[model samples]
Target: MSNMQHELQHLPASAGLEARTVGRVGIVGASSTGIGIAIQLLDAGVPVTFYEADAAALGAGLAQIRSAWTDTHDSRLALLAGTINFHHLKDADLVVDASETEGGEALFRRLDQTTKPGAILATAAAGAGVDRLAGATRRHGEVLGLRVDRAQVWELVPGRDTSDPTLATVGALARRLHAPAAARR
Candidate 1:
C-alpha cells in the first residue's frame, strides 16, 4: 500500500474516541474552513452534510472539495459529501458552526433547537466567545469552540458547561487534522 493509505490505516486510535460514535455531521457554512472539517471527518468514514444558504455558494464549495481529492483519497467522499437543509439536521450527531462571527449567536440558538439532544455544537470562529454562544442553548454541555487557520496555533476553548466527552470528541478530531494541537485555555 502507498504511504498515505498505510498511514490512514494505521492511525492510532484514541481511547473513547470511537469513530462510529461521531455519526452524521452537519456543517453550517460551505467555505474553506467548513470543507476542511468535512474532509477530516469524511476521510474517517464519517458522513457530512454541507449547509449553504446560497445555492451558488454550495455548488462552488462542492467544486472545491472535488478538486482537492485525488485518485488515492477514499472514493466514499463522493457519497459522504452532500448538501442538506436545517430540517434534515436533527439526525446529525455533531453540528459545526463554521461561519465567521457575524450574527453567530442567532445561528447557534437556532442550531441548539434543531439538533437532537447530546449533539455537539462546535464553532470555527477564531477566539470567539463559546461560553456566550452556549448560553443561548440548553445543551451548553455539548458545545465546544475551536479554530483552524492552517497557519497558526489554535485554542480549544470549552464553554461553561462543555462536558469531558465533548472536549475529547473535538480533541480527537483536531488531532486527526493536526496532531498535538494542544487546546490551550
Candidate 2:
C-alpha cells in the first residue's frame, strides 16, 4: 500500500472526517506554487484537483507532479486530477487561486459563483490582494490568502471581512498536512 493509504488506514472514521473538513482541495493555475501546494496536499492524503485555463499548462503540471513524486502509486496518484473546466471546482471544499492570469477580479467573481457555498476561497497572491479578491466575492467571510513558504509553513492571511471560523478551518488543514500556520492580518 502507498504511504497515503497507510496513513489513511490508521485514521479513525471520525478523525478522517474531522481532519478533512476542507476535503478535496482545488488549485487554480499550473504555476510552480500550485504544483508545490498540490504535492503537499497529496502527501497529506488530501485529494487535489487542479484547474488551469491552458490545456498545455495543465498537462505540464501533471507531468511535473508525476516526475517530482517518488512514490507514484496509482492509488495515491488517483487523488490528483486536472481540469480546464471552471465548474469542476464546485465540489472542492477549499480553492487556492495561484494563477497569475489577467482579470483577477473577474476570476474571483467567477469563483464566488462557481464554488459551493461556504467553501473556503484562498489566494496565493501577496499583500492586500486577498482583500481585493474578497471584494469580488459575496462570501467575504470565507475568503483569505494562503501561501506555503520555503520552510513549508503555511501563512494564512485574512481579508477585512474574513471570519474566525474560516481561519480555523484552514488552520486545521495546515495542521493535518503537518505544517505550522502563521496568521497575518
Candidate 3:
C-alpha cells in the first residue's frame, strides 16, 4: 500500500466543522489524503467540490470515498458524488491539493490562475516548502503547506508570506476534522 493509504486508514473519527465557516471547499487530485479529507468534511456537513483532470482517477477516488462513508452515513455519498474537471473554484473558501506527486508544484501554479482572490491555497507539499507555491500566486498570504505522516499527526507549514488569517483558518479546519496540527513552523 502507498504511504498515503496508511495514513488514511488510521484517520481519526470526525468532530465535524461549522458548515458556514467552511462554506465550500475545492480539492485537487484524487489522492489518499484528498479522498480521505473529503470524506471527513462531507460527514461533517461541509460542502466540497472536487476537481480532477482524469476521469478514471476521479472514479476510483469517488468509489473509495463512497465505500468509506456508505457504511456509516449513506447520505453522505450523495454529497460526495459531485465532481468537476474545470477549475471553477471561485466559490471555494479553501482550495487544497492533497496530491503527493512531483507535479504538485505545477498544480499550485495553475491554482493561482483559477482560484478566487481571497481563497486559501493549501498543499501537502511535505518538505518541499510552500514558497514556490505561494510565489506563483498574487495572494501569497494565503498559501500554506500540510504534512501528514503515518505517525497520526499533521503539521501545518506556513510560507513566509502566509498571513495570520490563513494560518487561523487552516488551524480551525484541522481541529474541526479532528486532525491535530503541530505548532506553526
Candidate 4:
C-alpha cells in the first residue's frame, strides 16, 4: 500500500464532531500533503478547493489525485475543484497551507486576510510551529499546525492564543476525517 494509505488507516477515533462541522475546505499549494488531505476530506463528503498560483502545478496536482484515486472517482471529483485565485478561499471553513515552498509570514498573513472570520487555518509544514504561523495572522485563535508523521500519527499543535473552540472544532474535523490519533499540543 502507498504511504498515504497506510497513514490514513492508522488514524484514531472520533472526537464528537458534528456531521456538518466542515462546510468547505480550502487547500493552498498542490504538494503531496495537500493532495493526501484532499483525498481524506473528499472521502468524507467534504468539498475541497485547491488554490495554486501556478496553473500548471494545479493541473498536475489534479491529475495526480485522479490517478491516485482507486475508487469512487466520480463522486470525489464532484467534490474537488482547483483555482488560481486566492480569494476563492474566502468561503472555506478550514484552510490548510500545504505549499511546498516556504512562504513564511507573508503566506499566513495573506491567508488570514483572504479567508472569512472564524475560519481555521492550518499548516501541513511539519517543522513549522503553530505559534509562528499564528503570529502572522489576525485570526490567531484560529491558527494551528496539523501534520501526519511517517508512523501515521497526527499532531494538532495549537498556538498560545488558540481558542478552545478552534481546538475542539479541529479535533472534531480530525475525527470526521477518520484521523483518530490526532493529539493536541
Candidate 5:
C-alpha cells in the first residue's frame, strides 16, 4: 500500500470517520464577517447555512462572497466550494452570530425558542455583553463569546456560569477551528 494508505490505516476509527463526515455550520448573518467565516469553514470542508434578515442584504452578502472568491481566482472556482443560504436557521449543529447590530439580540431570542436544546451558539462580537444577551434570552449557559483580532482568537465564558458543559463544547469547537482558549472573566 502507499504511504498515504498506510497512514490512513493507522488512524483511529473516530479520526477516520471524522475525516469523512462533513460538518454543518450556520451563520446568523450574511455580512462581511459572516461570509468570510463561511468561506473559511467551506475551505475546511464544512457545509454552511447562512441566515439573513434582509433580502437585499443577503443578495449583497452573496455578491460580496462571490466577488472575494472571484478576485482571488480567474474563473471563481471557489463559487463551487459549498452550500450557502440567506434565510432560516434550522437544525444546525453549530450557529454563529457575526452581526453586532441589535439583530444579534433578536437572533438569540429566536434561537432560544427554535434551536435544538443542546446546539452550540457562538458570537464573534468582541465587546458585546454576551452574558447579558444570554440572560435576556434565557440561554446564559448556552452562549459563548469569541474574540478575534489580528488573527488572534480567544474564547470568553461568562464569569457567572462558566462551568457549563455547553461552554466545553464551544471550547472544543474553537479548538477544532484552531482558536486559542482564554480564561473566563
Candidate 6:
C-alpha cells in the first residue's frame, strides 16, 4: 500500500473530528486519505462529488467509501448512496485535494475559475509547495493546506498568500468536523 493508505489505515478512531453538517464537498485524487475524507464528510451529512481521472480508480474510491461506512454498522448507506457522485466535479462549498497529483492541480484550477469566491479549498499535501499551487490558481487567498496524522486532528498549513479570512474559515470547518480549533497566535 502507498504511504497515504498506510497512514490512513492507522488513524485513531477518534481523531477529534466528528462529522458535522458538511453541505457539499468535492475531493480530488481519490487516494486512501481522499476516500476517507469523502466517507467521513458524507457520513456527517455532506453531499460529496469526487473527480478521478481513472475510471477504475474512481470505482475503487467509491467502493472504499462504501466499505468504511458499511463495516461500521452505520446504516446511512441509503442516504450516502446517492450522496456520492463519481464523475466530473461540480461547484461545491468546499474542495479537498488529498495529494499533489496532476488531477488535483487541474481540479483546483477549475474550481478557482468557477467556484464562489469564498469557497474553501484545502490541500492534504504535507510537503508540497502550497504557495506555488496557490499562485497558479485564481483564488490565492482562499487556499490552505491541511496536514493530518494518527495522533492529532487536522492541522492547517498556511500558504504564502493565505489570508486571515481563509484561516478563520478553516477554523470554522475544523470546528464543524469536531476537530480542535487551529491554535490562534
- In TM-score terms, which candidate is top? 2
TM-score of each model, paired residue for residue = 0.78, 0.85, 0.79, 0.84, 0.67, 0.72
lDDT tens digits by residue: candidate 2, 64-157? 9877767767566889989999999999999998886643778889988998998988988665377788899999888988877766667778
Which regions of candidate 4 deviate over 4 angstroms?
1-20, 70-73, 150-153
Question: Which residue pairs come into collision in candidate 2?
Answer: none
Looking at model 4, residue 137 earns an lDDT score of 87
For 1-185, candidate 5 gives per-residue lDDT tens digits of 65334423332222322221225667776656787776656555556677776777777776666675545663433423223333345666667788747556767777777676665667777576776667656657667676554453444545354334555455445446554544354
Model 1 residue 73 lDDT score = 58
- The digit string of per-residue lDDT tens for model 4 on 93-160 reads 99999999977789999988988888899988868878888999888888888886554345677778
* Over 4 Å off, model 1: 1-20, 71-74, 151-155, 175-178
lDDT of each: 0.70, 0.81, 0.70, 0.79, 0.58, 0.63
The full ranking of all candidates by TM-score, starting with the best, is 2, 4, 3, 1, 6, 5
Return the clash pairs for model 6, or none. none
Candidate 2 residue runs with Cα over 4 Å from true position? 1-20
| Candidate that scores best on lDDT | 2
The worst-scoring run of ten residues by lDDT in candidate 3 lies at 11-20
Better of 3 and 5 by TM-score: 3
Clashing pairs in 1: none
Which clashing pairs does model 4 show? 11-180, 12-180, 12-181, 13-180
Model 6 has an lDDT value of 0.63
Q: Name the weakest run of 10 consecutive residues (lDDT summed) in model 4.
A: 11-20
Q: What's model 4's lDDT at 57? A: 97
Better of 4 and 6 by lDDT: 4
